[model samples]
Target: MAGVTAMTVQLNRMDRVSPWGFRLQGGRDFRMALSVKKVEPRSPADGQLHSGDAILAIDGYDASQMTHAQAQQMIRNSGNTLQLTVNKGLFQSLKPTGPIKFSPAAAYGYSHGHSTF
Candidate 1:
């Protein structure tokens, strides 16, 4: 909590059927904390959340001590509009910088027009 900064984010179901357009990673294993791993471009969480932002709570429910599966389940049950309380700075040190390394085929696709960077 020392370096953490808490904030709330409200994400509405943009497509009405798709997932929240964000991926989460990390938990207690290997001493890792719960954090956002990715946010899809043009998605609801795209600009609202960032990779390495620690999930401190979900819909006002404490999430800092939750396991990956537990947190996933909570998100799944949050309905169309979800509220998330996150620690924006707590896990920023874990965020990756520069382009991510990919396999040759994937890299080619990304470099071309098949994927978004």
Candidate 2:
């Protein structure tokens, strides 16, 4: 993570429109669907997404075939009604077995008081 890990995540059409407030990160090869790195508070994705949850798609576009830009554009153009298919099992597997020792900030990919998102 040398440069800022950037990806545009937008929310579904609702009473309030806001950024989905989640960071999507993964290797560019698309061998696997991108994973949710963080979910911001009170955003549309906060309760529905979790860190490490594999994103299967946005709307009906398969995430397996998308580049970062394509994914971003798709979400931005989805008319405020983005639908996310998430794999919660993957997220559970990524969780620590013992009590969490790291700070919440660190867990969400914060480094040196700066957020990567």
**Structural similarity to truth (TM-score) of each candidate:** 0.70, 0.58
Measured on C-alpha atoms, candidate 1 has an lDDT of: 0.70
Steric collisions counted per model: 0, 1
- Please provide, for model 1 over 1-117, each residue's C-alpha lDDT reduced to its tens digit, 9 standing for 90 to 100: 475568999988855477687877765432567777778988878899887788788899888677666677778877788899988846643444688576563555522111111
Where model 2 places Cα greater than 4 Å from the true spot, the runs are 1-17, 27-32, 89-117
What is the TM-score (0 to 1) of candidate 1? 0.70
Query: Which number leads on TM-score?
Result: 1
Give the C-alpha miss distance for residue 64 in model 2, angstroms.
0.7
What's the distance in Å from true for residue 92, model 1?
4.8
Clashing residue pairs found in predicted model 1:
none
Each prediction's Cα lDDT score? 0.70, 0.59
Evaluate model 2: give its TM-score: 0.58
